[model samples]
Target: MRLPRSRRRSETRDVASDKSEATSQTSLPGDQQAAGAARRFLRTALAQWSDSGLPEAARLGERLLDDSTLLVSELVTNAVVHAGTTVELVCRLDTRESPPGLVVEVSDHHPTRALRDDSGVLDESDVPDDSREGGRGLQLVAALSDAWGISYRRDRKTVWCRFDLPAGDGATPLLSLRGEPPAELIAPVPPQADRANDQEWAGRGALSFLAEASDLLAGQLDEDNVASLAAQLLVPRIADWCAVWVYPAGAGARLPSVWHVEERRIDGLRSVLEKSPPAADKRPGARHIAWPATPGDTVGGGALAVPLLVTGRCQGTLLLGRAGPLGLPDEVTGLVEDFARRVALAMGAARQYARQAMISTVLQRGLLPPAVGRIPGIDHAVVYEPLAGDWVGGDFYDLFPAGDGRWCFALGDVCGNGPEAASLAGVARPVLRLLAREGYGVCDVLDRLNKALADEAAAALTGGTAAWEGGQARFLSLLYGEITPYAPERGAHCTLASAGHPLPLVLGSDGRVREAASPQILLGISETAQYTSESFDLSSGDSLLCVTDGVTERRRGQRQFDDDDGLATVFGDCTGLGAAGIAERIRHAVHAYDSAPPADDLAVLVLQAR
Candidate 1:
């Protein structure tokens, strides 16, 4: 099949002409098709440029081909999908002294236009699972391309992309249109000619963007902050225009709820659902619909609704949409879902704080005794820590001024925790304070409290025999103390009463520690239970420390407690630290002894003779 010389040259010229024509034809497509074709064509063009060996452009050609082509595709895509029209793409093979690359621009006829909003475009609810048909296109382009956007004109809009192709001796581009680019855009010089540096550069850039996004999300604190973070992450990363809403854990199927929004209106977005809510419900708290917008109409276009959910519960929904069909990618959707969970946790914390504040107010007012009856030379400071649980625990301390110059005080822990225990303390506190002021000793006060509790228990179950037998019975442990400050000639005397409770620690001015004298039966155990009170003399600078089981019984391991020995070590090792210091040491010791933070309410009362 030998041919004549003329025919052979003609064949060679035809082949060359065909390749040139193919390359030229790659540049001429409608905007939509051009963007897609550009991506496909660029990948192919990179391979061809590498093999065909334009040694100079080929030396830096791979890098230029990858970055320039990707940016070209993005600009073309944005111009086609968002700004509207078949764009004009211009790519100049730029070669100057320093290095070489490409300059690309895609222009469409649209002057007055809108930009992607700062919020995300993926509807929280419209995220598709891994086995789905679409998503993640523009997001990928945003990740890969260096810069992409649209420019305005009197008769048209020009979408443009600029890729700073790095300068590597083997494959990086140093400069193209002008001289050397700034240091930031300059590519690193290649270490080896055989190595493919451009692919590595692209990979590193993508990874850097992802790392930045991860760091941004890691530092968030509250639920609202999470939504805001999601919005921040999604906006240029995905499409634009995002909104997120979260429901309280118990807010299912309820209106007048809390929600977060980036944009308030998506005309017809709401009406579509209002007109057909049941149909929307089929997707389980999510719905998506898109319709083209006619000129002058606010409704229609791209729209998506997604649910913020955890454990199969619909906590809230996310609404995202744009005027055109900008695909909602799964990566963006997954990000929003993750942010939704954090938002839920943050809201839960806020709710707990509000609850704690309310209970604190009610319990503090209801439980502490009225002002001391003008007792002389007696000062008091009380501290109470509630268990970190559903309700505040029953721990109370009080100093009542009994008309003389002496003050009577008591500190006690009710058995169990929560409102029931707190209620018992509420009933017993004022009564015991009044009885002590009326000249009753510790034993008499105990007797009065026990009888009153029994009577109240009986009254609480007025319904039936069953209610009286099991429902209305409650028991408690208590400790009470009183002090009489003495003048210089007299040592102040102190008295304490314990019932089925830990001994209170007493620190003498001479650096000695001792337990309260005697212990007795807990309140509500035996109606006729006898109580004993121990008296000790307090010198100037001497102090008494009273506490509940919360300090001693804090669990450190599976079956370990910071027991009496631990408490003794804390009090005995006291190093001239005053009352406040001793209290602080005990608190610190408890914190250290426990494997985790102490879980129960802790109450401490300290008295130092002036």
Candidate 2:
């Protein structure tokens, strides 16, 4: 099987010649459609190279090809979603190296939208929450590629990943072309070193440590979690030991988390820190604390304590200790202080959100009707589901007695969500009740409310007061009605006024559903907006249903839950059910239409003549 010397050298040269470089570039629009096109173009180009007798083609197995296509798809999709500009993709096969490599570079014109962490891999700490739908794209790219990185220019940014091809005979296998190995290939085990070295303080290692620390801090909202994560990030990275002390509002300081590279020495270190003298000023600042050069403590060079200041208040203190002769460097000190600042900010936000959520809950409960009171000869049921978050929604419903033998009910939706919407609902609910108690009819009550809202809006537009700035005025759709019991033969009569709200559905005892009133202009839009009342008779066992648009507009993927025909069908199915039964049926159906939590507030009111 031995070959001649000249023939062997000729074969080697042929293989090396095949390693010559080839590159292909294409520009695509920044949109969802471009992802598929970019994938197709990449596959086509790679196939052409395979057919050209390139030596690297033999190593392009199915797994590698599929991974390349997937990475291309993810990167293109990221560009489309985040950049929103023309994207340029350059794929290059560099046969110049022994094993050769394929470099895929995706560039966008948006420099400001560059990735937060230069490290291509996005770990759990980088994402805001576990339930987040997006942000896993970069993680996929890092997993599939042998190496990846981000580069920035003045007006553009490029994300590049490299895939190495297996070497041919007489060709040496090249290591990863990029300096850093893939994050997945790196072992999860912590470093064995008890102390950080000068080498670990430079370049990618230091930068990566800081980036990961930032991500961890950003992801956590709880003060205890933030403190623990902050301590964990400092230990085995910049310090031999770390301890965090938190000072809650109107409470004394407490140590929540302590970490040390040597697990056995953690208790001793904690004791030393606790017994140590307090800092000179004890105010919100950072400084170095001197420790005695004892036997076990000789290696522990010095300690630095930095205050966690949030909104000009000292919330906590972060203490760190390093080993060996080197005192903390200026750069390291600055990095530690920056980390403390991030922790403080996160803690502040978490506390503020909790406070706001509690306030909103209390206010919402106060604004809503406590219970649906029993009106003579009337049976009713109401359902309210607020949007999932730490804020109240704009939807509101109330049923109360107006006067003798009359019960007034209202269902309305403000134009927005959150605290502003809740405030407006608070004002509207009481105003409606006051007007009704003053003996105003349905039409008269709506007219007065509309005029009041319009005047407020006009005053806000004219800068009448600072309190009326921004969201002082808002639009709302309302369905207001008063029910009065007649005689045993007639049952009850309902007088209703519709102000741009969804038409009320009247479910007849014989299984027919019809609109109770026509729509009108929404309140607060026009000063001259006219509203009129319509009268309807509710026979025994007949139910009137009023709802906010949240019920009708609920979506399953791309399709809505209830159009006109669908609503009618839903009503038709509830023919023999009582008011409470019918409301439950509709609520359950709306929830079943989509697996995801509803994005809007839902409110439903069902009143039946008994």
Candidate 3:
């Protein structure tokens, strides 16, 4: 959405020490951004007036500038919203008095259009009803100016407001907004000739504009926002109105984002453009195009359109419109074309990111088991959540049968995030499953998987050494185990190893907790790294917990979830809980540790002897 409208005033006549009128005038393109353009023009005039050093000119206070700018924004907005025509803005300071007074006036094409109520009508009188959304801008104008009123001629309507300048020391206004102006001033004076607007986009200003556009556009991961920002940056700067039409590949759906200097005319403009889209012109640069005038249109009907070319293909069009019989100047067309190129690049990047994320999501589903296999002698529950933005995160877990009377379980975290880390975890799991099914014990399964990951890392590094140290290492930390029911009355036999993972915890029926396995160096750090298994018996009413560091390393400010054996304490309290209940309890506690969502991937697996 566009930013909320600022309260501002009209422009008029000013006086200096020599009794010469000091004035600044410009013609606004009557689109939605006319208010913003008007505010900038008023600011320049005030700055010049302050620097002119006429009598009492040194006393231009912050309040005076703020009130004047807000007044101009309001009046210009009213004109653009309702009149839908070019706006004439004039600012003048009467510098002869003790504290100079500034006069401002904004004129529009619709001289006879009266205000309506909330249903979007303008009020005919000075006091608008409490609920006129259309007239609120004008109401704000009335409140900020010392004296303000409308001057209607046969051809133009002008809103003039006067502000008694404040002292630099910040004195209050001499008079409040007293509804209508003097009767003599209310009568229509001589009409004015529209001043030509001078636009120069070649220096620091253009650089700043493009720089700001880059910053805003680059952060947008959605193409719609990119189109919206492009339109906003164009209007009332180089073009009076703009439309970015994006065509989704293979879908034939045309999404057009339209913006105009006049907010009220946006719907009309959009409807017209959608009915008549530009040709799918793949040629580079920009050229004039035929744009049909909508109903009640008065200004800015001429148009120019450029292709939104990304890479070598044309995906859409960027069309901009302006006033006058002749179209935009060559420099403006060139500038807009350059701006459109940047917009195209941003859109391309967004689409690429979305495509990758989608692929990652699809691959994530394929990489993990559809459902954990049920073991005959154990009740188990598992909770797995990847980081929000990472479709394929670093954390993963699996529980599946290893043939015979054996069951294998593994939970692991790769060194970093994104695709590289995810690829490593993908390779590690399959190797572990293959080794376990081949009748390898827990330590042997770990050893074989470690070598496979190391080989993959070496192959990747041999291809390119420059990025090997750039978070591309395939090092892994894993907690792997195998279980067998040796006796029905007693508990199951558990063989497990912790390869730099969070030490697994065993909870006794009496609420006592202790580490199940000792820590070993992370796998894939070196192929020579060896592992050892810890064998134990879990009697009835005993539960074992296996977790990736994502659970143990969860942070709230400076403290981690496992800073002081936090996970062990929580596990010890789940003495009587079933496997599912214990998993949910720990998941809830981790999430509740901080108001924000967990920043890292998390996986929890619990096994209770049946």
Candidate 4:
């Protein structure tokens, strides 16, 4: 939506110096002399505003009057030559809180006849050329004033112009829909070419101040600093007061807080505080939210409040104020919002940097546990790689002893990724290790894990209750195992229990490879789930290779499969390789399986029975 028009005069010919002191005079007695006097008064007022210390007021004055003074001259000229009647001009400074500005009116005692403004020939087409000279009086008046029209009383009709000048430094005039000047009054003595030069010079002086304002905002994202610069710029452009405020901190949907304040006096803020704060929903963020001044408040000013938000979070607000109640234009409001966004991004970056550092510290401490304690006839090695980028892969390995002179270990993939998924792994990993040591069998270990995951999953679902749908809810995919070993020279045996985990690959002395497909049920689904154990015979020089899906599922181009047979064939065909050799072969095969690095996190564990 568009900003509303200002209601006071900015460029009046005889605007009073002390707005506090009211003036009642309008026109001088005679026609020719009065037109000349009006022109002179306008030139003087324009000069004073340009030279005055109150740049904000001067800016408002310049905006209100520049084109308007010319229109007044054209109107007066028309009354003298065409109306054949003396016109009475009355200028009043309407400083009311609602329609605060200057009003200029011209009245004549000719009620029987309407004022006909026909200073131009209507062509086949209605467009007017710049070269046209005779008919342009009423056109000029409508072009300048925020609103201009004629009203008739019983005996006379008054032609009046109302200019909205709230802060004394109002923005550029928004042209009317017709795109034509309203009215014109011709002077008996015309302005020479050199006189036009003087007006140009005056216009340049006014523009220079606005240029200063642009320069001040060019290199900074600080809203407070920009407001101060805007106030200073307004002063040199016109004689007026300036004020600014910031969006308050901790404002909610019910009410918003003010951030920064820049004003000529404390009374300006007091005036605003007396009125209700703007509705938060109407002007969500970084868009101007304006409020009218209180009825009896000591201040009369215009305000523009813009919120600063980035990534859906509010940073702050920028509020600018003037001495009267006028709102900012959309263009100006957009510029302020852009500045606010830049500031918000800088702040967000700083916060993200600190958070990343903290995450890194905790992850480092959670790296794989040191090599498991020695078992006389066995040698082992383990490797883990965390998935890169934002995703946190939940691959974990554990090794602990079962009381029956057997050692147990498990490698599993907990479904999902990132901090929350990592958090679930963080809880499940250590708990499983403790449970194994506490004599819980494979099924019992999974039963306890499911209980823990149930609570964790519920919290996740509840936290996103607004966004949750049945299809989008989270679940985990996990695998667990326990192994018991015996003396290999005596053709000893090992018993294996699995919880939906990948089968261990066995390489025999006869140059043959096979997988021990143990019966299994995935962990963390239900408490009553059961898993059976599988037993296998072993001898010296035999190797057991257990790994996560990240290894066998490695992809080259689009093809991906669990290459269990290929890996077993390689180990059995090579022959005579120990635990370390088997581990090295698996790692090499993975690197070669993909022309590029594997997409998921990879884990590998190898054991040899001597």
- Give each model's whole-structure lDDT: 0.55, 0.73, 0.73, 0.53
lDDT of 4 by residue, 449-534 (tens): 76665555566557976222233323444546565556634434565555666677777877778886564665555545555656
Model 3 segments beyond 4 Å from truth?
1-195, 198-212, 232-241, 250-253, 260-276, 295-300, 322-327, 373-377, 454-471, 485-491, 525-530, 555-559, 592-599
TM per candidate comes to: 0.49, 0.68, 0.63, 0.42
- Per model, how many backbone clashes are there? 11, 1, 30, 68
Q: Which 10-residue span in candidate 4 carries the lowest summed lDDT?
A: 177-186
Candidate 1 vs 4: which has more lDDT: 1
Q: Rank the candidates by lDDT, best first.
A: 3, 2, 1, 4
Instruction: Please provide, for model 3 over 542-564, each residue's C-alpha lDDT reduced to its tens digit, 9 standing for 90 to 100.
Output: 99999887788889999999988
- Between prediction 1 and prediction 3, the one with superior lDDT is 3
Best by TM-score: 2
Query: Which portions of model 1 show Cα errors greater than 4 Å?
Result: 1-239, 245-301, 305-317, 326-357, 360-383, 437-439, 457-473, 488-490, 557-564
- Could you give me the TM-score of model 4 versus the true structure? 0.42
Write the residue-wise lDDT of candidate 2 on 415-476 in tens digits: 88888888888899999999999999999999999999888888776876532434544888
> RMSD in angstroms, candidate 3?
17.3
